[model samples]
Target: MEYQAAPARLSTLDANFEHDFAQRLHWSADTDAAIEQRVADILADVQKRGDAAVLEYTARFDGLQVDGMTALELTQAELKAAFDSLGDEQRDALTAAAQRVRTYHEAQKRASGESWSYRDADGTLLGQKVTPLDRVGIYVPGGKAAYPSSVLMNAIPAHVAGVQEIIMVVPTPRGEKNALVLAAAYVAGVTRGFTIGGAQAVAALAYGTATIPKVDKITGPGNAYVASAKKRVFGTVGIDMIAGPSEILVLADGSTPPDWVAMDLFSQAEHDELAQSILLCPDADYIAAVQREIDRLLPEMPRRAIIAKSLSDRGALILTRDMQEACAISNRIAPEHLEVSSSNPHQWEPLLRHAGAIFLGAYTSESLGDYCAGPNHVLPTSGTARFSSPLGVYDFQKRSSLIEVSEQGAQSLGRIASVLAHGEGLQGHARAAEMRLK
Candidate 1:
């Protein structure tokens, strides 16, 4: 099993791919002053004109003849009927996805962390509590990219974690939603569905409207304008992360078939022109085989243009000295999806300190994780997995500290609290807690 052995240098690829799939890294570019000014104008008009302004922009941007009534809200009855109308097989599939997703996230749920009662000279108790948010807005991108998987991924964890209002927002082109999206929303148990989308949808969710209520937070992916809208609205409402085009890094050896790697690469590349696909191999021979396989597979694909552009532009067959070096390169990239197609995926599993999602072995493709594998498909891209995490129930839920100091505890705690507050020129703070003690 021969493979590419070491890089003479990373000549095939440049360094700035770290910023985005494109060499120019437009994902991180500052919003144009003109763009910000336009957004401000749209926001102000929408604020004054209400749904009329939203309708005008939706028509202009989305090119849909959305009725004012259809664009407003769905009744509870309509949502349930949609749930009931699901075909048996489709309904069963949705149920299966929901259970699998719930099981995986339920195990990850934290229970208020650890609590401790310390006895300094005096006895006192202190601890932390983890709670869930009451409401969250999940924006599902519609039009050409109507992903029910997103509806499932964004809502299930919130349900499991006990969010009271799971406000599901998806832009319906001319008030028409994809059935798959509606089905997923049904399975995930969302109480309301709003037929609004795009930047206007983000604005409405962040600020609230006569018809659409405000949400505590927003999650899910969208286009550049949607991302920018989320960025602008962050202070008013919490956001999961600013997403970029999808990306995947595969570490393969000659032991795996080249076709498998090519197909895996296509799964991400097909996402968009900006999506990234790369391979790191120790043997030069294997890199050539994989490259050949990608070319052969590219023309036959439905979205061949996108795949070709992504591979030709963003991808690199980085030659490394060994598997260790491959792992080191992966750490630097921190890609959204990492596939270890080596003979021993377990060997490198421990080395995966960063990655939005990890796929082990040749059979475990990134596509499965994107759909029914039970993990979220909404992940951090553009090297953000270095610090951020994939969207989960935690993204929708906000936690508050639970403080219920007993009379004894407060009495014992009062002097220190008062002294600290007084020292900080916050006598009111001192008086409030100290007076309670009295």
Candidate 2:
């Protein structure tokens, strides 16, 4: 089938630009009510029945009939065998990507994932104690595609943060296991592996099954069922984020090749039909060139139909008044992946404040960041980048405030606490503080 992708073309000077732009950026993260209720049922059932529920769901949903959870479990020996079974090229690439991700996360851990305290003049020690989670469950999507990269992006950071156990859960529909995924689990230091998925896997992770052991937190992306389960189970166990459709926004200055920008847009659009890819450029001719390139290159893509629908539905090619205006619009969008495909990306990068991750120059494509470029591919989507952040070592670790008040410090602090406690009408709190005072 022939596929054509013509993203909406809008000029910033137009009177209806705001309305048109708003319409293009609109994407609802609301899950279907039916899915929510079904997920709730599944979570409750798994929470109640434990391994029996997990086994039933694995057979019913994944078509993998196992005798018990033990049969569904991937042994460490299996993971190593998968790693050994890979070709030299696959093994080499996986090793290289894992090393880069590990190195970047190690630096991130050192920069922020450490405990520190300081003593004041009164010998009052105050700071924070940063610690890794005891264990974490990483959900890798194994339905339509195998995401070895997802395994690396999610588990490697937790390992770097000193997480002792990284439990991995991937849905293997029809009992077909992806070797690369198993190899990635070996490479990423996954402590346990389960060939199960959907809300059932999430439930098992969130509320410990008899076999699968509960985790302190769960990370990684999954389908809508998994997402709904995560949203529901947030209070019981921590989740990375409730991710939406993928997004990429390009701020161009007309200097870089339009084909590169077009392909970069395709990179995100190919993720799914709802994924968004937009380009904001000051030059009208450059925008036209990108459109031509998108048309020319999209036909060559295997997922051209998906790319076409995504670009037609949510994508835009806006003609900005200038690069400054482009940067402002990029900030407003706060896309999951922002690419400054310009001559001097750094100049505009400073002006751009909100983005999950910024790709700094024409050479830096969003795909590079998605795979081997060190930084995490898991990012806040659907304008959540305005306040949230990309997944990192910090997500896998938590901090506790450290405070040790000396006698002199306590005397000063006690009076202040007593006054505040009394002001708040908490007599017990006030009395407790007064009791500590000299």
Candidate 3:
């Protein structure tokens, strides 16, 4: 099939630019009502029936029939076997990527995941205690594609955060497992694993089955059903984020090769038909060059059809007034992955404020960050980067405020508390504070 990718061409100077921009950026996160209802049923059944529900759903959804939950579990020895079965090159690459992810998360832990306390003049101590969750479930998407990278990105941070147990769940459709994914689990120190996925796997992790231990949190991206399950079980068990389709916004200054930028855009567009790739450049000629490259290069890609559909549906090649205006628009978009494809990326980086991850310089592609660049690739998608952050050591750990009130400090604190309590007409609260006062 001859694939064509013609992303919407728009200019910042266009009269209806705002309307067109909004339309391009619009992607509703609403899950189908029927899916939501089905997910609820699954979650409730899993909570009520435990292992039996999980097994039944696994068989129905994944076509992997198992008599008992034990058959579904991926034992530690099996994970090791998967790791050892790999060729030297694959094994070496997995190990190297794991090490880099571990190193980056370790540094992140040191920087922010530490306990600290301070004492005031009155001898009152106040601080925070940082502690990791005892157990966490990291879901690896096994459908459509096997993400060994997702395994690394989700599990390494929890391992670095001192999470004691990392339970992994990946669907093995028709009883087939991805060796690379299992190898990643072994390399990332997954404590337990199950070849069960979909809403049932999420329920098993969140509520716990007879065989699957409950997890404090669940992290990783999945399909619509998985996403709906996570959203439903948020209060019961923590989730990473309800991720949307992948996105890449390139802020180019026309200094980088148009082919490189075009391929970079393709890197994201090839993920799925719904994925978006946009380019913002001031030079109209450079934008033309990029489109030409996209035309020439689309046919060579194995996933050319998907790339073509994605670009045609959601992608854009926007012409901004200048680099500064491009940066402003990028902040507005708050893209999941922002690539500053410029000669001096640092010059425009300060002007940029919101992105899940920023890839600086012409050579720094978003794909590098996805696999071996050492930063967590589980990022906030669909403009959630405006307020949210990439997954890190901090996500696996929580903080508790520590307070030690001295006798001297209680006198001052008591009076203030007493006034507020009395003002609120709480006699019990006022008396409690008074009793504490010396």
lDDT score, candidate 3? 0.96
Model 1 TM-score is 0.86
**lDDT value, residue 159 of candidate 2:** 94
lDDT of 1 by residue, 344-433 (tens): 899999988889999998889998888788888889888889999987756655555555566777886888899999999998999997
Q: Pick out the ten consecutive residues of candidate 1 with the lowest summed lDDT.
A: 1-10
Model 1 CA deviation exceeding 4 Å by range: 1-29, 80-89, 110-123, 404-438
Model 3: per-residue Cα lDDT over 193-227, one tens digit each: 99999999999999998899999999999999999
Query: What is the Å distance of residue 377 in model 3 from its true position?
Result: 0.3
Model 3 RMSD in Å is: 0.7
Instruction: Give per-candidate clash totals.
Output: 10, 0, 0
Please, what is the whole-model Cα lDDT of each candidate in the order they appear?
A: 0.77, 0.95, 0.96
The superposed Cα distance between candidate 1 and the true structure at residue 3, in angstroms, equals 26
Off by over 4 Å in 3: none
Candidate 2 lDDT over 1-438, as tens digits, reads 898898999999999999999999888889999999999999999999999999999999999997878888999999999999999999999999999999999999889889999999999999999988999999999989999999999999999999999999999999999999999999999999999999999999999988999999999999899999999999999999999999999999999999999999999999999999999999999999999999899889999999999999989999999999999999999999999998899898789999999999999999988889999999999999999999999999999999999988989999999999999999999998889888
